[model samples]
Target: MASLAVSLGLRAADPLTNLVGIPNYAPAYLAFHFVWAYGILSSRTLKQWYKLDHQESPRYDLVKYGEAAVKSGKITKRQLNMMQRCESASANSVENYTFFLGAIGFATFSGVDRQTVNYWGLMYTAARIAYGAAYVLIEDRKVALVRGLLWWAGNAACFALLWAAGGKLNA
Candidate 1:
């Protein structure tokens, strides 16, 4: 949405509709979707890693519950450290995602059509949720890579759109 507003000046009725041209909408939509995908991947990865570590130690099948696992001789400090790292990664992803959302909102408010901006925002939210579910439920490397590609492509599209729009608006 922010990308759209920045690329094409905001109009009154449709936030999703490009004030400058129809093509401009594609880039904004793609950027929004990609950000969403990244969020999904982050969430899915966190859930899987959490579930895997929550139970018996990765080293052994022995059941040592919660903090006891660390207190007893079962799990090492390193394993706990790894779990903390996963949490940190999730937190970082969330921060970045919010930044992207803010960027979209800023762009939208600047000049983009309200309907087009809103539409892209909705698409992005939905895609992110699906992406997260897919990431958590599906662990195949190929699937993960493909999903990641979708996000990259979306971001690339946004950048390209912005660049094209800039020539007209910024000038």
Candidate 2:
């Protein structure tokens, strides 16, 4: 999507340039997807963990379990509450990120005319898949850090690409 957007934008500004090739900003878009995907996959793992810990129930009773765990001295109240809050936040983040991606995709399809932007969008999707897998399966501190850094770098690249593209459009 980002690639398409970039392509359209570039074409609008200068029609002679070929817009099908990958743009420099592709990495940045990839990073954004990486982080978002990681968040989503991790959240799923969290949900699974919650279910396993609480037994196979129709609904997650995290709040109830947390309270009970605290009352029974199995866990501190603060810890229980924090865990619940984290789970809730993770769920919300996954939904929000998915929506964001969908919006970008929609914009690209709606005649935004930027092929570079569309290409970036594809990169973002790939990065996001990797990011999610890493978040779910990797626990090593260094590995985790690298994944996070890559995700951020991708985002930074996207921002720079957007800024550069915007300049081109206006020029």
Candidate 3:
């Protein structure tokens, strides 16, 4: 009985699932995180490849590529700066997802209701995807609003997971 409760992410007295189940949501979120990061990093690579139109450049650094393009008058200085900003933001977004994955893992193993934890995990991932796209693709005044909303939503879901776990505590 105790083993089944822990496996189902329930406190011993909280009446968790009697059937078998593992902490699968953690891996699912991790898988999506990897795919998300891969898409962002790959897109950046493709952008660099397209800049030279399939011709291989000795330098793979995006800012260096931008600098060469700027010097050659192929792009403006401000454009080069924005390119670096987008790449930085994409990398930072991936790092943020890694932190979220840690929190999700803890929540899953700490005996929170799996369904509730999974729901919030899904929310956080979806909002993160929206936030990353808004940050990288949108460059208008409205970008802040769109990204801010998603950030708040994701944060809310993170807190909700903790709250859900707290509610299940035996105390």
Candidate 4:
């Protein structure tokens, strides 16, 4: 393993590489967005889960279910609003996935160092998670500025990754 890291010009102690003990970390980092979105949308403790617990699989058409429930008076509009916010956060994650995947994928394939890739991956993930959580939990427009900041922070990581990848590719 140490030999493998040495061969790749990567340190054994780099965070994601250390976590997965692999030369490439892009795929793992990319897949985490799916994991995060799934956890947020369908996790056991989420209100949407309990509200839609009657279904065999609530995730297939969560928006439809939530809308129907609200229309039929089974759930309140406020409840629907929260569910939509959660869904929007998950959708935002999915929406951002392609760009992130491209940036990180290019970085790893272009020979960007493992430590740099892992650091940006960690930053992107943390900022995105905080952004999503804040989006779901905060209703105030004033406080919601935090979510916007986090979104920019995550985007900064992606731009940083692209810059690093471009440098490596150019060299």
Q: How many residue pairs clash (N, CA or C atoms closer than 3 angstroms) in each of the candidate models, in the order given? A: 18, 31, 0, 0
Q: Which stretches of candidate 4 lie over 4 Å from their true place?
A: 1-24, 42-50, 53-76
Candidate 2 structure quality by residue, lDDT tens digits, 85-132 = 445444544654544454444434333345646555665455545554
Off by over 4 Å in 2: 1-113
Clashing pairs in 3: none
State the lDDT of candidate 1 residue by residue for 79-100, as single tens digits.
5544443344345445546544
Candidate 4, residues 25-117, lDDT tens digits: the string is: 567887788788666443333554446643566564455576777788877877666666787788788788787888898888787888789
Q: What is the C-alpha lDDT profile of model 3 across 82-128, one tens digit per residue?
A: 55556655676677776677677667767777777778888998888
Identify the runs in model 1 with alpha carbons over 4 angstroms from their true place. 1-89, 153-171
lDDT (C-alpha, whole model) for all candidates: 0.46, 0.50, 0.67, 0.76
- Total backbone clashes of model 1? 18
By the lDDT metric, which is better: model 3 or model 4?
4
Instruction: Give the winner by TM-score.
Output: 4
TM-score of 3: 0.69
Q: For model 3, what is the error of residue 87's alpha carbon versus the real structure, in angstroms, after optimal superposition? A: 1.4
TM-score for each candidate, following the candidate numbering: 0.42, 0.44, 0.69, 0.72
Report lDDT (Cα) of residue 59, candidate 1: 24
